[model samples]
Target chain A: MQRVPELLVEFYSRPGYLAIIRHMIDTLCGRLGFTPAESSQVCLAVDEALCNVIRHGYDSAPDGRIRLAVHEYSEKGRLEILIEDDAKQVDLDTIRSRDLEDVRPGGLGVHLINEIMDDAVYEHRKEGGMRLLMWKRLPRTAEPAKANQEVDAGES
Target chain B: MQGNHEMQVNTEQRDGATIVRPEGDVDLSSSSTLRTSLQEAHESTEGKLIIDLANVKYMDSSGVATLVECLQLSRRSGTTLLLCQLHERVLSVFQIARLDGVFDIVPSLDEALAH
Candidate 1:
């Protein structure tokens, strides 16, 4: 395996900062040659993961610091995203999407992250806090055909 | 950056249902606004509740959770919850979570209104 280029961003754990994080992910996905739809999916998955860190890990405190890194291996056509927070360690064993049969609010973040990303892993940092690692394999050939479908739908 | 991005929600009565249109991205930051709007619409109307997602380009699990909340409320109150105009991206979120079968999804406002 070869070392990939990485982009790192550190921000306060606050809901307001989600937009900035989403924008950063969007730009990184675009540079990786992901279609608009795929880029949006990647952004959404990252956004959900970060939100879980802020709400669950940090307990909604804005003072906690969140470090996000995006690594792209162009040769391998893979992307890795890591989100680290200095909050309490989360029990990875208990992280599961709630039963959809019982519809209700909350408990969907973990499920969405798992569904969108190719692989999702939560780890307790040896030093402190927790780290969430998510990976996505870019399609061999980007689908540009469906990129314009949203535009056409909007105009109709 | 506290209020950089906000979700806009508008409600209108269509036929016998309440149409709730949310514009912009619906993530963690804006999910509360959407939840409050949906709650109010659910409480005020005795008819169907239609969520038009045509303008929502992006939504995360928080947004999905909010909709799930509304769906549960509708079932309890015997009100129909119909979702229409789901963007391909937004719809995929529902499908990935295996929620597409849980909610009544329609392709357009007309179909939602028809039921």
Candidate 2:
């Protein structure tokens, strides 16, 4: 029933915030006992979401604050991350995928975000801001290969 | 917030490869450095262009997109572009983007040098 653990942060939407996000995930997941692959996926998805805010929400102006929260739902077997910014709101529907064949150098953040997370959604907060809600289910069992290895070791 | 940082780029032609060495993070703020290095290498060399990312500890979609641009440029200019020594986090970015298949990724500088 503990779906909302107290995790929150607020910072300027600057490029440097990327590293802070990475470190936060590492520390939080370490405490939660996440597997390496799960930790990596979460880190990547958070990066994609924050990068969108930094890129589109602020429009590289660096004058607004980004509010980020991570709620660990241990009982529900899921983790949720929410990112919001008070700058010029991004109309998420207007976002488009870059032509993979064109090989250009821009506009692929949304695609990466959609690819990494289990459920990704964007909404316009009633208070005039852009909010991104992302959720993923934590695996209920240990990796089969690792579990098998542990059993084999016990037998030996 | 991580401290503000800049990127340094270097280009050298050795053993039939144009090696572009960039030192620093490759997020939105610093991808321009990668662009400059890749462009400089392509202009100067008619051979393969190898991007040595050994010193690059961080990168975002902007950085990977820059590499994709460089790959396209290499194709148009008839030069091969290779990426080597990608740090684990940087590699993870590529994997999430599903771009690992698009680039010639090698384990080390020596392996890239041979190709």
Candidate 3:
């Protein structure tokens, strides 16, 4: 196992905390040499996962606690993220993205997360709640500085 | 990343359509505001509805859901809902959900209004 730098964050499972969580993910990915586009994709996937934990996992109660663990394995060129919540165990079989033909609101979050991340697995914690494990392969030719410059140029 | 701030929605009448421009990130925390604004636009306007997403850099499922609701409202009321100038990141979210084909998405606001 390669030694990877990890970041752990704990917060109340509230919608308001999404901003901070997004910032942390952005910074972590930026440090890991992910390009702007890749960083945004990862952030969006994690954001959707966390939203699921808050909305479905905790039933939108805003009383439960959520923990996010992010690990960057530079040697393996992989990024791993885990989202844990002590609310309810998700029925893996029932957790399918809705049919696009339906064209309705809700149920799109899971699909977006599954599409952006390389791998996503859900496990019911023995103690309580559920844990979501998501992984992404960091591009080997990540040019963080150039990506930043491009974003800056776009903004200007 | 844009700071944690409430979403700001501004509405205007443009070329026989209601143009709603929401600035800042749209997520679970701020989707309701957009929802209310869109509802108001739907009620007040008989013409088409255009949403300019140029300034919205990030949008999650909640935001998408809100738009879906707006689309439903538009259809029921015989109004057309068009989205314009979607940021790349936001557009990717729509594409991932396979909503890109369902919604009337255009490249720019002028184009959306023209159609």
Candidate achieving the largest lDDT? 3
TM-score of chain B of 1: 0.94
Scored against the true structure, residue A84 in model 1 reaches a CA lDDT of 92
For model 1, the stretches where C-alpha displacement exceeds 4 angstroms are A1-5, A141-156, B1-4
- TM-score on alpha carbons, each prediction: 0.87, 0.82, 0.90
The candidate with the higher DockQ, 2 or 3, is 3
* Local distance difference test, each candidate: 0.83, 0.76, 0.86
Q: Candidate 3 clashing pairs?
A: none
A106, model 1: CA deviation in Å?
A: 2.4
C-alpha positional error of residue A35 in candidate 3 after TM-score superposition, expressed in Å = 1.5
Q: Highest DockQ: which candidate? A: 3
Task: For model 3 chain A, give the 10-residue run with minimal summed lDDT.
Answer: A142-151
List the candidate 3 regions with Cα displacement exceeding 4 Å: A1-5, A141-156
Clashes of 1: 0
In the predicted model 1, the residue pairs found to clash are none
Per candidate, native contacts kept equal 0.84, 0.57, 0.95
Error of 2 at B44 (Å): 2.5
Higher TM-score: candidate 1 or 3? Answer: 3
**Candidate 3 structure quality by residue, lDDT tens digits, B42-84:** 9888789999998899999999999999999999999989999
* Interface RMSD for each of the candidates: 3.9, 3.5, 1.0
Candidate 1 residue-wise lDDT, A50-91, digit = tens: 888898899999999999887765456778898898999988
- Show the colliding residue pairs in model 2: none
